[model samples]
Target: MRESQPRESGAQAILEKYDRESQFRLNLGKWGLIVTFLGVYLTVFHLYTGYFGVLPSQKQGAIHLGTALGLIFLLFPAKKGMQKHQKTVPWYDIILAFLAMYISYHKVIFLDSILQSRITGYHPFDMILSIVGILLVLEATRRTVGLPIVIVAGITILYTIFGKYIPTQLLSHPGFSIDRIATNLWYQESGVFGTPIQISSKFIFLFLFFGVMLVHTRIGAFFNDLAFSLTGRYTGGTAKAAVSASALQGMVSGSSVGNTVASGSFTIPMMKKAGFKPEFAAATEASASTGGQIMPPLMGAAAFIMMEYLGVDFSTIMLAALVPAMLYFTGIFIGTHFEAKKRGIVGLPKEALPNFKKLMLRNGYMLLPLIVIVGTIMIGFTPQRAAIIGIVSAYLISLIRKESRLSLKQTIYVLEEGARVALPVIAAVATAGIIAGVVSITGLGAKFATGIIALSGGILPFALMLTMVACIILGMGLPTTANYVVTATVAAPALINTFGLEPIAVHMFVFYFGIVADITPPVCLAAYAGAGIAKANPFRTGLNAVKLAIAAFIIPYIFIYDPILLLVDVTIPHFVLAVVTAFLGMLAVSSAMIGFFVSNSRIWERVLLMLGGLLMIHPEVYSNVAGFLLMAIVWLLQRNRKNGEVSQSAAV
Candidate 1:
């Protein structure tokens, strides 16, 4: 579990290069003290609100946005090269930071009077502030989150201003007056303070704090140790262990690239040492780490957003996500097993693996924090309450062992880290809220949905395909939070309205593709980060990641068609059948993708495995029967071929 300082530094450097969220000022000297105090204050503010009570929606959001904006401007440089090594905050950034805070506080101070007046028009003062506020948000977003979302928001604003001039009926609307636009985008809950930021401020921040506490308590190491113990002696054990550990870490870890660098720094080297190709080693970790965003408990903080968008309870969304997540990891695990078999790679030495029984017994208490979070939510506590308890439980549990315990200084640092980590999310969601606000005022969601249906010729499968592409493309550039918000805002409506699908299914479908975008080609940040660690080709790693994570691409389509795979309104027998068959389906598909099964598959066999896998996964009795028969046929043929080869060798 111990890593050299240089390895940790290498991982940090990689994280900073690819993951914008990790690229922040180190707060040298006096600036360090200032950043530290601000970080602690941010965390404490959220914890205090969660424990006592939150302010009104607008006020709470204003505080959250204001604090986050200030921190982001101070912590992240205007340009990557402008603040090399994060030496100090520039004077201009300091002024911009204060301006951003003033913009947010403008809402908090005048909210009562504005609501009391119930005026539809913007005052001159509010109007100017609104314009400045929007600009400040975009600037902070560019500093912390990147430009894709900022561009999207800018387009929405421009559309709002000029929509009346558009010749196309479907795409155009009567543009709002500048006054109305300013009021709606700033003063109302629909814009910067909309559901996205509401959820971010209220729920996401607490869960993020819980994740930080988990790291402080060394639970990440525990997960790695536990995974190595369970899988390190099996075939392609190191790679499999990476899958297991990354999933565990990704549950709370959230950022696919971040998780990749964190665990890949440990697992990728071992995988290379174990004789797996560098690309495959990196791909395995990248694919597995990406799946963590879809896993339950936290789900990269997407579950809360889904809860709001779907208007469903937290448990429903979390439960629905389970089977698909399992199938995703299964695909990766099976692919790794076959790859190891094909390469004739053996497992790690048993003596080198940790003893599963003893390790669990010693550190079993570490799991209670997660258990506390899930258990409380299931038992009817709010997510905010559950997260607060989870954070406290992590600290309490850490005190059980001297090595796991955090000192007062470390505890404060954990708080600081929690707040610092949340800055990018805050910026992304608030900017995305502007996009969502535009969609609302312009009635673009409905129009966009209609356009999608018309474009797809009213075919559900075709619409799903279109939506999938949109999600991945948007995901490539957006942070997970912003990606989900944008896709769920625009793309999800297409599927939900056109097909009358389960809202959860529609949302989960978009959610899955968004997370996998991290591994999709051309701009696959997660794969790029993994390749950096493994010293492999980034594009090849992305292709391998897409291959290894084939189930993620396939599962969304299946769930949309079957809904059984998503565990919506299914009987016990049917649910069990769906899961088992789906698992078998993954086996076939994974083997086909890897070009290996039971002693290496022939090309035609690979084709059949794929066809049969898809058929079996369809959840129809007839298809399952035919698919199973095909899989059996291939299994028997491969087995016979292997035996014949052995006999021929013996005769020779």
Candidate 2:
């Protein structure tokens, strides 16, 4: 076997550089032990609550956020580039850490009193804690989630406190007093302890915990092996396998950058060795990994929040996501396929490929946890209940192989790792709650929606384009949960209220764009992470990722114009017809984007193919027919030219 040290160290460096959550102090001996204990305790607490009954919303959110705040202060440095040399927690961070705990838990300690004082209002001390608590949350958020979300939240708070002085009548609010803002944001369930955190505390954490458990079982390896077993011997097989593996791993890995580095570390090297260009290799992985957020079941922990926002069950969200998710992957898959063919990149030799049947026979049980979670949820268990069963199932399944089995110490480590992995998400959700709280309090969501509609001059397509832009901008800096929260709050309403679109469609629209931000140009972190592994240019990798995942950009509009693509109120015939046409549309578009279809496509052929794809994807009978005709014309021309060449070669 290859010496794993180089790859391991390289991936670690890339992760630390790209993913802030991975940048943390380590090996501080006693401090590390304390951090471990806190992490384990945090996971166990959630596991206990998930199995038994959860605490009241305020109490649950408080404990969860409090523990996370403490962890964040200890594990993450206030500044970047300090993790490598830091030996001990600073005195100030230690103070801030403890204060974070106390301020966050003050609500849990005085729940009854706080409730009693709802009408009478908060005491001076209570208000002081509220003020400090908000600041601490913001600071911890800054440390773990990066400063953009903090800036956004900070701006929102400023708006909340000073909106009355705004010059514009449309955007202005009556404004709020400090006490009111503090109480609403801190003490009340509407702010730091609001729906976003509540879901994070309740559903997302366990799913994250479950994901961590899978990590310990080496399910990631299984996923990679499974993908390779299926796709490794086909044209451009390695790249296809990367997409397949990343999609599977990305759902559980929770972050696009994390997934890209984890899978790309292995896949990118293979692609480069297999004759693919470094930029294309990195782009393929980045695009595929980024799509993982749109994949069903976890959807990067956004599905649970969507359930709450759309007032639908987990199953509905899953079903709604299924088609678009598939289309997104299909786009990337086709891109890889075409690139491989274009470059004459063959699959790995058949002798080197794993046996699919044997691979599944040995490790197929690893899939049970995901199946169990989905099955239980569909059968009426709460997401928490389903996740608990999933975690337990994952543990039990891991024991089937002695190699995968966790010793007591390792199991404890898994718990600790689960909490540690969840810190960024916890901070993000809590901070997102601050943003959501402001929106709800100031009626900003409605106004923002109205503004978008007005700005688009009431054109649905234009409004969608604007909403997509907003989602991408917000998503560039926000975590998945935060991105969804903000967009769903401010942007979703824009499409829904004006266009009277299905709620799920509008929400999915924002959800899709928010996720693609990780691969979109400028600040596409997932692509950058992939580029890091592939030793390619980050900006070029990002551009390639955008090209490869172009369907992601187009699919949202397709669904928005035709909700049938989302499986919203669809009939069998229509659903099948929609899927078929969409796939065809994607194929033509993918070929056009790649400049290859049947053969090396001419520029005019690519243009016609692109136009044909858009029309076919539009979901009208006339356009579908027209698109088919145009695509058919290109196919014939390319085929005739290729056949003529073949005949000429044969004669020679």
Candidate 3:
């Protein structure tokens, strides 16, 4: 009924303008200022640490607390409104911000010389600072992410405090003293400024900065232009373009829902104009956008976190991620192609499509930064150093074209923008650190693994199912990085302990599921964002996204079962076999979902095709042979039906 109300284009224009202005102000001031300072601060600290490593845990805690608090204040709004002169800062906000900074900055005051000389010890001032910092972090987390993560964090923290009173199996040693807890959380390396914070400060920020520099160099736009040139004249051109653009966007943006909203705004309308149903259009965009987080080069912040958590080289993780990432995009692209065929959608006119040579000539330089980044990292520079080099290269490359020039003001703007984007991620990592701290202190990770193993009867599939469910549930509320952190700590070890899966494979499995949650139902934010643009039912769009991304859900299991897909322990022949089988499996799954191969498939055909896909996914001689046979049957039947239909139509 509400949808029946007449809309005013002028009013909509005013609202859009208002929102843009408000967003700009928010980005430029609070979010921008804090992130810029944090970037500079962390860069300086890292440089100093690299030259002269400090062992002071309290000092480390202080730095973490300060950065976290700064992010909280800048990234989150005290309240939402449009009044230009309205005072957005509340009294409590000021109190908390100051407290967080004080606690972190004055960590030395809290420790005795012995504690300071050995492990960080409790000082009175440190106690006060820790309390304030913790409170601020909780409040800031509540404001930025949502009540769910804060509630989860609060419950976990509370459980830590009250473990002594719990049942035997769930309990821990009569837990830490309040002062000790504060000191550990606020001053120690195990707490606020631990691995998560270290990863965030050292790796995540540099990548975020790299993304900013890439954007300044017009690399993202070049990607869009390249996609347009490549796909703008194919059948269902807009949707194809959306897929290409989103893949490129995903490589840099690292936020699925954000990427969906960004590229979807353009591609969705174009799709609708090209005769796609609104819901299908939205689903296409959402599913494609969500796949971006799993894209190679950069996967949300999870890739960096994975490198830290696994203690593997960045290049190793990137190399391992390649096949799975390709499989993800391949599935989406195949699914979209089938859907286009089913609907008989047409592409853009030839006149509107960009000339390939001309487009490449203009934009080829835009790709140099990414090339340099991968090359430098492979040549053995630390990810941090490589990222800095990439950032510099991006800036330098921007100067080649007048349109992509990065002025001094724009450089500051990019820094500010990069910082703004990095804030929520910073908070998520810091909050996730609390979960990691709890697991480390209580050995709860091992306990949880034991429980999962017992429940799963040590069966690999059962354990994987349990892990996937946990990931989806957690990912419904948390960002990809936090989701990966929580699941990797809890479920990854369970698979390793129970199923004997490698640590890297187990972590990758959890990470994949966590990122897939963006398109999963109930709380599929990327799908919902797409629906908003398409004016389609959000639930329907989400369901469609799930269907479209079914391969992503299944492929992780395949990789876990047969690590060759992830390039683990493989001969050349085996690797080739795995690639061929996986490709066929994806094609089968896509065709089944779309119900169109050469023509419309019957119910039996669909079921058989799906079975073939499943068989193809599992690595075995018999299953692969059976899958190939079943696939051939479906193709022959579809071809026969299509030829018959054409003959009949010709007669008519």
For candidate 2, list the clashing residue pairs, or say none: none
Please provide TM-scores, in order, for all candidate models, with all chains considered together: 0.97, 0.98, 0.91
lDDT of 1 by residue, 1-652 (tens): 0011133578988988898887676544456677777788889999999999899999999999998998888878888755455556778888888899888987889887767544655567877888888889999999887888898889889999999999999999989987788778888888989999999989999999899999988999999999999999999999999999999999988889999999999999999999999999999999999898888888877678889987877877788888899999999999999999999998989899999999989988889999999999999998888888998899899898888888888787788889988998899999989999999999999989988998899988888888889899888888888889988988887777778898888888888888889999998999999999999999999999999999999998888877987777899998899899999999999999999988899899999999999999897999999999999999999999999999999999
Question: Which regions in candidate 2 have their CA more than 4 angstroms from the true location?
Answer: 1-7
Rank order (by TM-score, best first): 2, 1, 3
Compared with the true structure, all predictions reach lDDT values of 0.88, 0.89, 0.75
- Residue-level lDDT tens digits of model 3 in 1-652: 0112233453333223312211212333343444556645654554444335543644654574476576466435554433233334444555666666766666545446525633544557657766667767766666566566777777777777887877766445566666666656655567666777777766786787788778777676778878988988887788888888888888887877777776787789888888888888889888888888777787678888899888889898888888988888888788878888899987888788888899888778788888998998899988877887787788888888788887776665666566556666777777887777777777778888888888789777787898899999998888788888888877788788777888888888999889888888888878877888888898898888887788889888888878887778989999998889988988998889888887888999999999999899788879999998899999999898889999999999
lDDT, candidate 2, 114-144, per-residue tens: 9988988789998889889989988888888
Model 3 scores worst on lDDT over the 10 consecutive residues at 16-25
Kindly report which residue stretches of model 1 are placed more than 4 angstroms away from their true locations once superposed: 1-7, 117-120
Candidate 3 lDDT (Cα, 0 to 1) = 0.75
Model 3 compared with the native: what TM-score? 0.91
Error of 2 at 30 (Å): 1.4
Q: What is the lDDT of residue 137 in candidate 2?
A: 89
Decoy 1 TM-score against native: 0.97
The clash count of every prediction, one per candidate, is 0, 0, 2
Runs of candidate 3 exceeding 4 Å displacement? 1-65, 79-88, 108-121, 168-173
